[model samples]
Target: MSAVPEPAAVKTAVITGADSGIGRAAAVRLAEAGMDVGITWHTDEAGAERTAREVRERGRLAAVARMDLTRLPEAADTVDALADELGDRVDVLVNNAGTGSAVPFLDLGLDDVRRVLDVNLVGPFLCAQRAARRMIARGEGGRIVNVTSVHEHQPRVGAAPYCAAKGGLGLLTQAMALELAEHGITVNAVAPGEIATPMTGQEDTDVRTVSRPGVPLGRPGDAREAAAVIAFLAGPDASYVTGASWSVDGGMMLMGPMAGSHLTGDDWRRP
Candidate 1:
């Protein structure tokens, strides 16, 4: 009989855009799962500090850095900075930093499209490269979870850049999974829909009291709900899962056709 190999221990993680929302929740969840954390914020330093406090309260070490993904290849250095501060090896990385635009597809300026693509797609690509290099050098397996969105699979009227970037990222996840498998690195994506978070302008609001008519669950998802899936992918339990896009959308994806069939006017066209 062959003996089973022990699952690799995840000692440290680097999470970007963790100053609020799903990123914040994922950082805390990972901390609770017994991993030191490196948190990155774009503009909300105070919010990142609060997230760090939560991680520390969980008795895990926490480090913070400012990561502006729009800065491109240079901003990705934040990943290495965080990894270095947290003991030189990143056992997990959550590329949660992103931006979106709501302009109509024809109205999007080149700069607007570029900014969205750079922040949402290019940034995660570079960060993953940096972390994967470290993981390879360390000779230990690693996990990477990219926080995409329902836009990855379906399009909204005013989200040209967002949909483009997320769709690209979803495909990137599959490519990374195939190539990284040889290095014992697993890559996956978590796509959330209508989650109550700062990104969706729902900060500090109780999700249970809000309603999402398009979602079959009848409510927007909690950031913690998405974070739970992220934490699972980062931990040993999901060791065998990779290249999969887990939708934490409360069945929103299933209602797309239903929603289209029920629209009554052109109001849906004006983001």
Candidate 2:
């Protein structure tokens, strides 16, 4: 009998804001699963290189680029550039770059709100469009995972812009999923709650040491925990799953009603 040839391996994945935290974790996870990764950072080239080193240590190819999500259509060029460096195809795109504003709605400046939306919403939109176009052109299925927050489904008191941008992204994920299904593309969002990442000022701290009473999990989530869920969505098992916002929040979304009832005064509204 003749020997059978194995299929060729897929090309690469482009992950934005992958210098640290959940983005870095996801990059490492996917690389461990035998995928080459392209990492992008805003101001942390050193951190990005560190992540690339980790990916390389896993025996996968790694590429790095600078991507400022606020730069819009121009920033999205990084995706193409990365694809060019990684065999001219991107099999997965993770839009994990985002910024948040802690100011109250009334206290927020227009520029601040715009900046948040530019990073969290507009940036993902542009990148997804660009990646999807490439995926469709290549006639191969692709995956897109947007790293939203718990606020994507619920509102936060002091994070007006962040909440709004995440909420919009939740819908955008569904929209992309619907429109891209015919092209074998899957679009989804991962909503993480209270992850122990630098964004929460918890970098290098053990998540088990943090107490989050409101979260049913009793402690903040680990960045790797969130990354695992993202990895599942990007892998072959998620071929049938699309247009879903997977909550990697440790059941925190279930505490909304109980938390609201416990709020006894206006102090909670003051930021």
Candidate 3:
């Protein structure tokens, strides 16, 4: 019998803010799918290490790096550093690191607004640019997934900065997809609503435990649920998917009109 040729090595995925929440879930899921993972954390070194451990447990190489999105260029450099650690190539980049603000628009500070934009919008732009450059240079197609929010499409009472940043990111995803398509790189966004994660102050809680009347599903979404969408966008199945925003929000967007009709007072508009 003729000898069979060995398959090529698995690709690598770099996920920002992988210390926890959707980022961590995506990292683990990608690792499970046989891709080496590079995880980045801002202030949660321990959490990043835990995620890396989970990735390694799945029998994939895992690398960890500290990335502060405020330092956009430096933060982008971490992707290159991680690629260096993971065989000099990056096949997927997940811009999941972000910050949120809840102050009323009138009370929001200028500095705080800038911080949110820097982290949520500019940071991801730089990171994606860096990854795209590498992918284009490598002459291989790649994936880029941005984690936006339901607020990207709808307004939130006290989340002016967050909403603005996410909305901008949503459009940026489409623009990048248009520009990067020629290079065979797909750019997409995942908009998650009421996900059970530390960012929502729901750590260690089952999504089923939360009650969200606005969501048709009647509960929050699990981090893994959002991660599954990201994993799909980053995998070969999404080869034809680009310039799109996937709502992993359990039909939350559908309740907008209903929520507006049920609003009986002006209190929601108050600071």
Candidate 4:
């Protein structure tokens, strides 16, 4: 019997915050899977370049752009610029550029809250809107994978704004999915737990082992593993799956109330 030929790759994806952490990993992994990736960085031009180099080395085209999501005025323009760089077409868009804050609710400044919302929610919404327009214009469907966090469902004591932004993003994903379904566009989210990356920078100790004992997976997730999940959702395989938030969180969310109660130290007093 004769062998069948492999299918050719068809798409280009734009990944924000591609300079580091999950963004960088997604860029590299998607490119390795034979998809061209458009990389965007907020400040780390060098880091973005490094990721772009890896993509090209893997035999995929990569286009790098500078984008500061916190600046809402530039969010749509940033997406348009990236699409232009990719020859006026984009097949997938991953909204991953976000910041973390350990600021307590009482201590959080208004500016900080706005910054988080602008970057995590507004930025992604604007970018997705722009990308969807291009996809519609080209008369082809597209995919949008929002890089949310485990905090989207679970609460973190010192991370009020972060949690709020991610939760909003989860809802936004659902909303986008419903509205875009007619156009064959899918919207989904990848909510990762504690992943080993520059953002978590806990090299000396594994927080997941000591802090998250209730989780089915004892250790923290690697950025690449999280990236693989995002890549799957971005690919054609996830066409039927939309408006869903996939938890790549070592089963943390599944641990229920007991797991959350264990993380609370407020009841413990030093008398």
Candidate 5:
């Protein structure tokens, strides 16, 4: 692709794992903001199609591809392919694909840990590199948002591998932000807390009715809540923001000290 002047407004975005949950939300949200989007899914092509349909409904172009993060370097190529479909423009990239394990630390096997790392850390790492290179080649600034979990900052008892991967990705976001700032690129992490999504086994449930006493908001967050943050980071409004971790946790992260002292049983030890 040849270099071209940057558009005044972001035109295209590529989001990984857009088959469902936060990924799907972000895709539609970006489309609503007048951006064409390329979506990637792991094993749910039907769900991806649904997400694409929503994007197109907003009159924005949408493309879909199967991306298996476990495939490593090869899987990341999906990023370039999607950019090609978007007319060779990649203004924003959302590294939202990830996997998790609920097994205790001692019970975690080597292979399980590797799998988590591959999906959560390594895959996003490579995908961002591809998007960043394309952005640089076009001589246009870009945006990159990594969807980390609240665990990225705090630890949980049964999520050893998940925590490790998210924590690593969190730091990686900062490093990339610093290095890419010169290129007019901004990198940030959107760390989400308990959200009512398929990944949390609460798909389609009304979060307002589900009380979460531990969270100051007293309820789980909606996927759209997190997507709003991602959209802000990708849009022109957040041009000056970089290397920041925006928590969409509904104040869950603020309960660390309160939860630590109020725990009355060992139930928290199990996943």
Candidate 6:
């Protein structure tokens, strides 16, 4: 058998919220994997520029754009601008920008709930639509990966809006996959557990507890680890994989309410 050569084509990917956390990791990894990257940051230009620098070090073209996802009117235009700047329509789209609310569900104002939904759900819908249309016009297969979270399936006490939005995103991924498959486009999602990142907080007690005896892996997931999954789904290897919600949660989802109930039992070690 002959070894396959590295891909020579110069692919382009547009990643939202590329300034930090999983988004930052993904941008760098994709650039290293030989893809020109278009990145968007909501506020931190410095961080975005740093990510671009890293991409350049990987010897790939990098374009940075500022996007406030709340301004839903600008979503498609934002994608078009990146496609123009990158000199190719997006071959991959990673919808990783998301915000969460810690307030109790009852105390949450309508505006706050709406804000979360707009960024997490509506923003990705607009961006994916724009990117898919361009890719379909080109008559080439493309990939769209939504960065969901474990909360997409499991409910959290104070994260009603975040959970709801991600849950909606899961279904949206399926719907988009069905609709876009005919156009040679694939839509999928990566649902990560408590990953160590700025978004998760370096000192977050939640992440620490997440890796306790409760979790099967007994540790919180790393941002780079999550990025690896996104990279695979974005690359050619995932051609047959679409409309799938791949959970990167260290088996957290498998731990039901009875996971720890047997911890006190002497027979708990039998497994």
**What digit string (tens of lDDT, one per residue) describes model 4 on residues 63-151?**
98899887776766878887787778888999999997888799999999999989998889999999989877776788899999888
Query: How would the candidate models be sorted by lDDT, starting from the highest?
Result: 5, 1, 3, 2, 6, 4
lDDT of 3 by residue, 167-201 (tens): 99999999999888877888999999888899988
Worst 10 residues of 6 by lDDT: 1-10
lDDT score of residue 44 within candidate 3:
93
* TM-score for each predicted model, relative to the true structure: 0.93, 0.91, 0.91, 0.88, 0.93, 0.88
* lDDT of candidate 6 over 48-97, digit per residue (tens): 99999999999999999999989986865778898889986788999999
Q: Which ten residues in a row have the lowest lDDT in candidate 2?
A: 1-10
lDDT of 5 by residue, 60-138 (tens): 9999999999998999999999999999989999999888988989899999999999999999999999999998887
Please provide, for model 2 over 1-271, each residue's C-alpha lDDT reduced to its tens digit, 9 standing for 90 to 100.
2222222244589999999999999999999988999999999999999999999999999999999987777999999999889989999999999889778778889989999999999999999998989887787778999999989999878888999999999999999998888788889999998788889898877988766666666677899999999998888888889999999886778877236324344444346
**Which has the higher TM-score value, candidate number 3 or candidate number 4?**
3
Q: Which ten residues in a row have the lowest lDDT in candidate 3?
A: 1-10
* Total clashes for model 1: 0
Q: Who wins the lDDT comparison?
A: 5
Better of 1 and 2 by TM-score: 1
For model 1 the local lDDT of residue 197 reads 92
Which runs in model 6 stand beyond 4 Å of their true positions?
Answer: 1-10, 203-211, 256-271
Displacement of residue 217 (Cα, Å) in model 5 is 0.5
Evaluate residue 104 in candidate 1 and report its C-alpha lDDT on the 0 to 100 scale: 89
What C-alpha lDDT, on a 0 to 100 scale, does residue 52 get in candidate 5? 99
